[model samples]
Target: MANTPQSKKRARQNERRYAVNKARRSRIRTYLRKVEEAIAAGDKDAAAVALRAAQPELMRGVTKGVMHKNTVSRKLSRLSARVKALG
Candidate 1:
């Protein structure tokens, strides 16, 4: 429980930020899923396109503090490797 006014305000802010970050994370997951689907379909071109589209979103997650830089980098690396192997 927040006893002080500032703490209460911070709680509210945290809730709002949590929701926003949740949405951003979900959006990023959707993009990653698209890339996975493309790879599963063995369509290298589509996977590459999906990866291109997802890279920015993943980077944005890093910038927005929703995800860590190294986390995004590792994800991008694994995805790119999978995409490359799709051929």
Candidate 2:
């Protein structure tokens, strides 16, 4: 569909970026899931440790443009609250 060379290049770049972003998103989700599972298990110490591990990954997602800052902020806040409540 891209007739122009520039458009073709742009399409290729988009594909590459898409793959990278997808991987980043998946990685972030994995980190978040770990925290969720810890929380669900009601292991306060484990949940706290998981949250700490996830914090940097979530922030990395925001920095990489894979996720919005406020979204990450809200997630962190809620997860921290739940972890706190678990104890």
Candidate 3:
């Protein structure tokens, strides 16, 4: 579909970026799932630890433009609150 050389280059770049972003998003989801499982199991200590571990990965997603800042903020806020309530 990209007729011009520049457009073709951009298309290739987009594909690469898409793959990278997909992997990043999947990684972030794994971290979130860890926190969720800990919380669901009602282990406050484990939940806290998982939350702490997920924080950086979530922030990295935001910084890398894979996710929006406000979205990450909301996710962290809700997760932290749930973890806090697990006591």
Candidate 4:
């Protein structure tokens, strides 16, 4: 459906970007899942470690435009609170 050369190029670029962003999103989710599992298992130490590891990944998602700043901020805030409550 991309008749114009520019449109075709844009479509190609979009496909590549989509793949990259999808992978980034998946990685972020994996990190979050680790934190959730640790929390669910009631291992405060492990949960804290997982939360610390996940924080940077979530921020990276924001920096890469895969997620919003406020969304990541809220997620971090909630997760940190839960981790703290585990104490």
True-structure lDDT of candidate 2: 0.95
Candidate 4 per-residue lDDT, tens place, 1-87, comes to: 999999999999999999999999999999999999998999999999999999999999999999999999999999999989997
Error of 3 at 86 (Å): 0.5
Q: Tens-digit lDDT track for model 3 on 10-77?
A: 99999999999999999999999999999989999999999999999999999999999999999999
Over 1-87, each residue of candidate 1 has an lDDT whose tens digit, in order, gives 999999999999999999999999999999999999999999999999999999999999999999999999999999999999888
Candidate 3: where are CA atoms >4 Å away?
A: none
Q: In the order shown, what is each candidate's alpha-carbon RMSD?
A: 0.8, 0.5, 0.5, 0.4
Per-candidate TM-score against the hidden true structure: 0.95, 0.98, 0.98, 0.98
The clash tally of candidate 3 reads 0
Best candidate, lDDT? 3
Model 4: pairs clashing at backbone N, Cα or C within 3 Å: none
lDDT by residue (tens digit), candidate 2, 1-87:
998999999999999999999999999999899999999998999999999999999999989999999999999999999999996
How well does candidate 3 match the true structure in TM-score terms? 0.98
Cα lDDT of all candidates, in order?
A: 0.97, 0.95, 0.98, 0.97
Runs of candidate 2 exceeding 4 Å displacement: none
Residue 18, candidate 1: Cα error in Å is 0.6
Error of 3 at 30 (Å): 0.3
State the number of backbone clashes in model 1.
0
| Poorest lDDT segment (10 consecutive residues) of candidate 2 | 26-35
